[model samples]
Target chain A: MIRILIFCLSLLCCHHLVARKPEPEHIQIQPVFGTENLKLNTYYLLNNHTDSILIETLRFYISGIEFFSRGECVYKEKNSFHLVDLAKPQSLNISLAGLAGLEYDQLTFNLGIDSTTNVSGAMGGELDPSTGMYWTWQSGYINFKLEGHYHSGATKMQQFVYHLGGYAYPFAGIQQVKLPCKPNQNHILILALDYLLQADFSAIHPNIMSPGAEAVQMAKMVAAQFSLKE
Target chain B: MIHVPLKLAVICFGLAACRSNSSSFEKPAEWPEPVYDFSKNPLSTEKTTLGRALFYDPILSADNTISCASCHSPYNAFTHGDHNVSHGIGDSTGTRNSPPLMNLAWHTSFMWNGAINHLDMQALAPINHPDEMGENTAHVLQKLNASNFYRQLFYNAFGDSTATGENLLKAIAQFMVSLVSANSKYDQVKRNQASFTAQEQNGYALFTQHCNKCHTEPLFSNFRFENNGLPIDSSFNDYGRMQITQDPQDSLKFKVPTLRNIEFSFPYMHDGRFKTISEVLNHYTSGIKESSTLSPLLLNPMVLSSNEKVDLLAFLLTLSDREFLFNPAFAYPKELFLPAPKD
Candidate 1:
């Protein structure tokens, strides 16, 4: 009967190309004002060549937005965590293709806040540590609070502010960043806090709210700001 | 989002609904272990009568003329006695000196320089202090949800008629944990039904040898933060607990007051400057000031005599109780705020 209907239409087109699934990608760290403004302002101070010193307020926060296939690690939580905040850049355009664990490689979380959300009481957007970034009085949670007033030249031009946060134990804000993607499919990462004064931390100790150990040196000056545009 | 509740009902519709105090009774025996954590909001009795009617409502003060009994006044013991400061709302005052809300369940921290670490958020620092009770916890929860007796006493202690600032700081931590004073007279000499009198037992053996290592006794206050030496009021340059822990070793310290009712919490430290506890035992036996942050038990200097400051003011007037200072179930409920206050 016509060669058994051409072997069942080649086994239903190889089960619709191995159950198509891909969609998890996003990369919008846009904030340029130097190297001739390509446009994206919330006070740009981007960084590069690993000297990382992007100032004028660049924030960070990402958590398990995961999705992979080949290297494992399937799709993640309902809305795990993501607080970019250039004050609010329309939720930084992210899109990770049709996910379902297809050999994934990188993109883990935390550059701050992990004392189980500081005793887990009251939380809204921008991870609401009551957004004074919390330090109403000698307590914790100030993973980072740059604050401005730069300039330190010849005679009297100093007004720097740096309210970095702490988690207390000798003070901690445990930062982390990993990049490299696609074993099966899905990836997107771009956290660029200007470049955090090229990781020198304005020669260390600008300002910190509370926690301990000078917020572990501003979480190693915000994990040296993070790169890899791929 | 619990802020102005209808301009807080044209100034507290007579402290709407407040009258709950039963303290579920059994908190008696030896008493010293509370530091307030009733496991994050427990004690009921309609949340201590809606936190003693939002602590004597002047709708928690903004334009409704002060009310945290206008500066902790459960008649001198909740303490505003002889006003050494603490005036608030148009009467302005305060640079420090109100200190007298009783036993705060025992206190791990709360102002006088501890700065609110949680007595359920210390009535949101005097209800949003522009200068204490300037009212604004989402407009004091829209003036207790435009009171129908505080939405039925917050639907009988939080079944969500909604007043939130965490249930108005857990209904003022259930009327300051029903202001438990533990039936004073040193709790009737620890319930041996009272004894003391040998000039209040030589002022309780010179207050357990110079204030039991920072007032520690049946809840006298081992809450620590010393520096008792005074001297520094250059017009309230008050650096108590080092202006909230910028920490120069908690410079000019503070915290430690609870001598229970130190003869009606008088005008003492934190800028009420010795308004007599015999000028605070003559400045702890002749005004000390070696201060590298003092208090190694006031760093040596305590002479007394003059009948030991009248037997330490007769053992601080036996930490007064008057049934917890005339607690007409913590008065002013005037059948839910009417025209009382004639006294």
Candidate 2:
């Protein structure tokens, strides 16, 4: 009987060992805005521009993350959509834990919520309508929101609020961004808005609450700002 | 060692009981599969009840004066009769008519213009519209968090008292999708439980000939956007689907409104231009304005006589499901909290 009991215990131990799943590797993507240590609502000089601007809010969406190497997909984050808000430091950090032991040369993601989820009604989690990224009157998610004060030539209102978003055809604000990355180590994606400082605010429309040529232009402009940190 | 099998059996039984507690959402065998996936947002009695309460509560509004029920009244088949265009908080006039809410699970898109594609996200439009609720989700959450009644309700539905915006929208959607209207006279006839009258039968034939292409059976909407050639209201200047798609080809196109419960959900059409069913039929027959983007079905004149119109109206009446409109489970939810508002 003792021999039988010992055999059963060994079998149970082996079964436990076989049942264990492999642990996935974790990596973080941090959104560091222009010139690092840039505080919100603080007046700063724009690069080679006469206007001193104060950025109050900068929020945008990043989705459909795909890691690739040698023209083959190494890892693809399932249902990967994230809203990165500059005001909230925690919102800037994204976890790539699902891609454990994956080696990739490049990664690609969209700068706006895809058309499918935008029309798919009230989604839960980050895609929730209550997140303020969603437009109530017009049915679409605002891809990028940039609100700040720009030096106005003569207008009484010096504030500029550009809520750029639209996923429909012709003027679709969905921008695809692909960047090269190191193979083995974890990656941190950086978005530098310094280009906006050089960009003439006088020429750009300030208020873009709906889908139009202006919203599309702003979406493209912000999408071009992403780069991998060294 | 002997008790191990017994423990496993108990766990299995418990899981089975939990699954059984969530009564399966039934889809009528005759109907096509629903567009809304129930697997992601499983239905439970508690969650539905919570959703029903939220639907009736004006607390969702900025001033706590307008609930979803304000525009979508159960008595009127979930649509108001008094307004051509929906009236919102402080009597603010909206641009479009309030569409009736029923059989939404089958719908792939929402709104006359098809601005919203998903039923779950539909509430955000009204909730945040300055003319409607005029409240953001974050503000609504703050109000819900302060209420002891909502705290308990949220805890009962979601297993936590903290009312997140996601949970709030999900609960509302759960209630809206639970509103299934598959027990109309037409449905009864289809199920072999009852037969249509001669007038209704004749009307059904006429409908099949003239309207069934767009107003498909069962759900009564093909759920496609079409320009039915209603002359543009110069004041509102609403371009309909073209506003969203930006393609001039989609000009004046609106999502085909469902014809179910047409008896009560009157003040019909996207802009509520027709008050009576006869007027609507007359418009189709005589008032179809010629347009570049007009639906191909309306390209030729509809030659329906006065008698055929009556027969068609008779058939349309059979689509009204009183059981669905007056189901106590979907009513004001007085048992849950406050009494139903007296209009």
Candidate 3:
């Protein structure tokens, strides 16, 4: 009788050990201008290395991360909203505590906040309005912002600013990104600005402060520039 | 076993305390559920008190010369009385007239153009506009953090001494939502505690026939965007809703202004174009400018005789809730602004 009780206690201990939570997995986002690391306020070559451009600010939101295996969602991050700023290094690394031991072949995330969260009232943490990502003139978040100057000629600089976001119908700017990934690996997602800069800078309007067809088009172009670093 | 009932009693007492705290924001008997999700920012007496103080404080402005109440004075039905367009810091004038503040919890969108989609984000427009408060929200938070009085107020309201933009906006919203103007004569009549005069009764009939579709009963607004045909002011040239939606069909379209407290909330129209209630009536009867996006209901001109206009005006007066305009709670919180208690 005593041997049977001991056997039951050992089984319970094994179950407890098996159910222990695993350590969190990390995903690092690296922003680059072609092969070089992107730096704010620093001049970089663009448009086939013919024009000099300086990026003063570059910030965008990444949210609603989900991991899928064989077309089934294996893990999803709760309240997954992150604001990645070129000026802030620590913010680029996202820790997914839920992704531990998950054998997922696909990673998915929204390039901007979902429409539901945009309509919802004041939120805290990284989604806070004080983060300067929210548009005060209108009730929506600025999903992606890039402001800088382009050198038209020596000593002649033209300022360019882009504030891209809209959650309303007929002009939703949020982009969903799906990428293939290896199982049990820390991922590095690279945002290649060179691809984004390939657009005719002088031809397209340099300023896009409000949401419209141009903002949506630009947001789509920006979303296409993200890729898994090889 | 004895502690179980004791714990249940304690929980019941706690719930009762919470109920008493939110008594300031009571919904009217027949009103629809408020569009604001109260679960996100629950009403509390302390938060409302803090919000009232912030609303009256000029520290929200960059020059410390203007406040929300500067233009939205309580006596004027929370509107800028006699001002065609509201002037802000540095005497800079804004293009649109300041909208009155009442029954905000029922509103799903704000501004004359419906530019703001939520009540919580409405204050940002005036606060950040250069011609208004001319203040950055982050800078405003920093200033609040610097003040000992605000720190205590923040702590009392949110249990955190540090002031954040989220808390600041939420606190202000608490005060605005509490400004319910449900004690008007019309409301009293609706509740069967009072009766309308014969002229008011006739006017109410006419109202139901002509204006009730847009300016609905109870709340006095359908809260939908419509183009009431006022000719474009060449000076301002504001294409109201089209500016936000970027669609030509929305040109000249504006959110239908609530007729509640219309007697005091003039000069009327988005730009305060009409000075008196009669002028507004005249525009409805004769001054509708034709456009492709004109409201289908207004395609046919309204014909109200002069006597009918007077009756309409008299009925409109019944919407004036003096209790709301003179509520001491909504007035300037002089007690809070007094020198902070010595540390």
Candidate 4:
């Protein structure tokens, strides 16, 4: 009888240990130009398929990922910062662990690094200054970078480069994005580059390197392009 | 209940160990809390020693010709003496004067125009500037990784041999933030350990009346970007703070520099326009070119008699901290750099 009781208690302890382990969840980010996948150096038709744009570089930061269920936060990813680059295929897929059994229907994240992290000196991993996403002339992370050439007509192809970032007042460029998601399912987040290309390039100017009113406006346009892939 | 006392003792021991590890950086009792956050990058002897080596290493610059100390020498209180502007890699001359690097823990921003927001990020400006070090952080990391000496230093400082940008910048910041200059005779006078001469006392009074608003006492700088009414030098076309902020109102504005070690840090001003303190005093009295954004404190004309200028100069001399200038700990680490470590 004593041996049987000890066996049952060991079984219960093993079950508890198994229950404490968390399962991994993946978040895949897909960058697209219109309905097609984004390809660097490939010209894509824009503005009712009239103007053509050739993307040379596309890099941005995604940070502060959090999940919500029933209007309450269910899970927040620790050290949630990822640098997604068009050139690096592996960076597009982000694996989040220790989120097993989490009931989350909504996802929220910052399109750029937060102000607190910006002021904090020197960070490793995706937020590292060596990533080239950081502004060297000034001390702020470049939230979104898109460099390419645009051709409209008989005019020469113009280069359009947008490096958007600023943490200070009157021009803070970080944008928060929230999307509805199905619980317990791997998520696919789509970033549509067409919406950003649709803007009148002449009025906005093809070159924006520093953070200012133009950067803030451009960041807002870019932030609006993120959506959950159904 | 008996175990609780043992736990308390363990906690106390842990706290003591932590304190000893970070004791490399100390805050003076009279000064305000430092602007640089210490908790993020705690001070340690190994890290600071590594930082000192990096500060003197030319590998940070392109062509390995110039280091930070080239432009910011300790003898001149970190400013390049006799040079109006900074001379960089390939003999390139920069537009603005290289500012001194002391009491940096108190400064909230860096550069003449306050371009850098943090000390860790400040080195990036010069390292990448075409007219300065002319090297990118990525290449610098590759070079550092290739060097066995740097690898060992990195291992000692960060407990890893690989040279990452984060650790590199943090190590450099440790050396910079450790440069605290609070041991001047002026400070001693405030501490009641010394007294100022009658001439210095008169000069101190004059300084309080004329310059104290901008160059405040103790740290000797309010650290605000103010247009001090100097006419723009069209050659450089440098708009000072306006270049950074894109605000027309900030035109001709520059960060107010600390008055400590004013005696040795010659050729003053953002452009190093004045060669002597008397010349600087002359600018305040007669050469303030009025502008839309001129500092309000300088809005009124300042008139100092020649004798009063002499007295003020005497008071400024009291700010020169010989101990800080000659501190062997702050000097070049020859033992670490010479006779390169074997791989």
Q: Chain A TM-score for each candidate, in the given order? A: 0.31, 0.81, 0.87, 0.86
Docking class of 3: medium
Order the candidates by lDDT, highest first. Answer: 4, 3, 2, 1
**RMSD values, in order shown:** 20.6, 8.3, 6.9, 7.6
Q: List residue ranges in candidate 2 displaced over 4 A.
A: A1-37, A47-49, A64-79, A95-107, A119-121, A153-158, A168-171, A183-189, A200-202, A212-214, B1-20, B338-343
DockQ per model, Cα? 0.03, 0.47, 0.73, 0.73
- Candidate that beats the other on TM-score, 3 or 4, i.e. the better one: 3
- Displacement of the residue B96 alpha carbon in candidate 4, Å: 0.5
- The number of residue pairs in model 2 that clash at the backbone is 3
Tens-digit lDDT track of model 1 for B102-208: 76877877788886555666666676667766666666677768766677677667666766556766777778767777777868987989888899889888888
Judged by lDDT, which candidate is best? 4
- Residue-level lDDT tens digits of model 3 in B163-278: 99899988999999998999999999999999999999988988888899999878889999899999999999999999999999999999998988887899899999889999
**What stretches of model 4 exceed 4 Å from their correct place?**
A1-23, A47-51, A98-100, A151-155, A202-204, B1-22, B340-343
Q: Which candidate model has the greater DockQ, 1 or 4? A: 4
CAPRI-style quality class for the chain A–B interface of candidate 2: acceptable
lDDT of 3 by residue, A1-230 (tens): 99999999999999889878576787889889878988998888776555788899999999999989999999899889999998999999899886777787888998998899999988888888888999988889999999988876577778889999999988999999888877654688988887676577424778998888888988888888887864
Better of 1 and 4 by TM-score: 4
